[model samples]
Target: MGKSTASIDWLHRAPPVSGLERIEAYFSGFGYDPHRHDTYAIGHTLLGVQSFHYRGRKTHSLPGTTMVLHPDEVHDGWAGSDEGFKYRMIYVEPALIQQILGGKPLPFIHNGLSNDPWLYRACQVLVQRLDCGLDPLLEQDALFDLAHALNNAAGVNTSRKTFDYQAAERAREFIHGALTRTITLDEMAEHCGRDRWALSRDFRLLFGTSPYRYLTMRRLDLVRTLLGQGHSLVDAALTAGFTDQSHMTRQFRSTYGLPPSRWVRMLGRT
Candidate 1:
């Protein structure tokens, strides 16, 4: 097979987020280079064989399969066969998944792919586009279901028993409220009534990323929102807690394969 490293063609049609963005696209060929994202690339492969190599393994994504590419992992993408591959993915900061998982433990899907039915169904809500915002109660329920489902998919049911889960939930809420605000592990721990180190470990187990990373995502989510609302890039970056527009621009380009100005221009044409 010929190697081709293209860029991710993104349709940023997601609800405005500060730290992360949800993207939908149908790619039929190689769609990435040896690039890494600051966020979690979570989504379903809709059709054909979406092939990518990461962590020293060649993985193929068939239809109905969910692929979880963890943060900062080097990976590349291409079609596994002549037919090409198509997928719809959401670019979520690990923080959101962390928020959903809380201090439990980050679910690990070995080989970066899964044919899990429960996970397939949970992803439906995410794939429904931003218009289909989950109702508060429904959102919470879905998230909880997703948490357990991920745990099972990642084979993290070692305890196999009930345990206090409220801390994770509380930590998640703190992350949300402090999106534009600065939050530290110690602060989150103090608020959630847990030791800082214990809280950090649980956070990794449940969310698959670190607390600091989680906070950065929250900030990025705000950046998206501000930009979508027509704020100037510099203004949005500052309002979103980035040091400056360049800081935001670097992350935006790295994650979405384009800068904020270019992204907005593309949106105008669309």
Candidate 2:
């Protein structure tokens, strides 16, 4: 018999660039299990049917459509048809959006798919190709455009309480500096010079996630970097400030939808 089309599946991780992680993949059958990550899972379906469960609904993304999965949203991926799916995704941190928007609520596109031309254009720049990465200045400009396009496409949310951008930013900075150490709401309060409860609320409103989740995401980011440099899971876990490898593993699976081993394979690192 000729080669079986059902047996085809592969994933390729683009070379890591500062503040961005990218992947191009194809699957002929099933893909990932139920998983969610702490970054904006933005991409476009290139061929076939890319299907996923998001925000309590099953969404089918067709070719030429954009997929914008929000940070911390529970979602799962797989092929919507036997022919499988092909797509490229960029996982971007909310902090990058905060850098551009400066304390505005993270934009939320209602459904997982969009035909917004501005968004499509902005995203195309980053997801265009894997071999040639964006130059620093160009990448920065792309990020800016993406941020604005997301904001415009997502529209505005009324009835949100007044938020403190400066205070939230201070807390975010503190988290970055102290990722290898224990972080607490009280400590963040002191660092941001705001009441503990108030700061927590502000952080969520401004960054689209709680302080704890933000901290964990940053630690996971470090773990990814360390692992890419050939660090063992245990070593990366310790260096990333997790209590143990198991603890890091649990968080990693919850955030990225796969264990370290599978993640390595997905990146073609294994």
Candidate 3:
């Protein structure tokens, strides 16, 4: 994908894949507000300095380093210098990671950045070809490597806790099937055959986010799809199970750091 000119902010999204969203974008100045989503944001700076406020401190990502923002962590983005910055990012759902890691705690790059060459290589395979869709087998292979690379870079977790992976997986599936309607914790627990609180705790430990966040993110995923298919905001919001347009808009901006209108505009530009 071509980089946007310094005078314009633009974003180019790749063909969609299940459990992943990839995009290449450029910004001359401020990029995003403090926002977060229920997916791991991993990528590298392709040009200039990619700056963000993560974990209560400002961090700058330069070329040749991999940036890994943990799921649901608050962060903001901007250019670190006047020249602007361009980068490609892939958001991977934690459930996909859990599929490979088998219920282990999600990896955390303490500083939200990694200089590990193995990690850089793994990230490159996913982000470098944003314009081209990956083959199913190739993508799965890369994800497996990426998951292990992340775990290795973050070091082994010495503290272990008992978690019911099967129950959490069942609950996740229940959430997916019920995205078009409201779901209660008790209901999900009954379906998954686990205690509500225990299921919630296990879900967080295994998936790196709460069950509610995962459901909301999935709904937002549907909203994006509806919007792409020319649905109006209100229509998309309602169809995605949100209470109203304003409700969806607030959640959209809070999760993505920009309003739905702006996102649509950027998509048009791309």
Best by lDDT: 3
Candidate 1: residue 25 Cα off by (Å): 1.1
RMSD of 2: 3.3
lDDT tens digits by residue: candidate 1, 40-89:
67787776788888799888888778887877566777778776676777
- Which ranking of candidates, highest lDDT first? 3, 2, 1
**Candidate 1 stretches greater than 4 Å from native:** 1-12, 16-22, 27-40, 47-49, 70-85, 90-103, 125-148, 159-172, 175-194, 253-258, 265-270
* Residue 167 displacement in candidate 1 (angstroms): 4.8
**Segments in model 2 whose C-alpha atoms lie over 4 Å from true places:** 1-8
User: How would you encode candidate 2's per-residue C-alpha lDDT over 221-242 as one tens digit per residue?
Assistant: 8898888788999999999999
Question: What residue pairs clash in candidate 2, if any at all?
Answer: none
Model 2 / residue 76 / CA error / Å = 0.6
Worst 10 residues of 3 by lDDT: 1-10
Q: Estimate, for each residue in 1-270, the C-alpha lDDT of model 3 and write its tens digit.
A: 123233478888887888988999988887877899999999989999999999989899999999999999999888888878999999999989999988899999999999999999998999976757788998999999999999999998899999899999999999999998888999999998999999999999888889999999999999999988899999999999999999999999999988888788777764
Per-residue lDDT of 191 in model 1:
93
True-structure lDDT of candidate 3: 0.90
Error (Å) of candidate 3 at residue 21 is 1.1
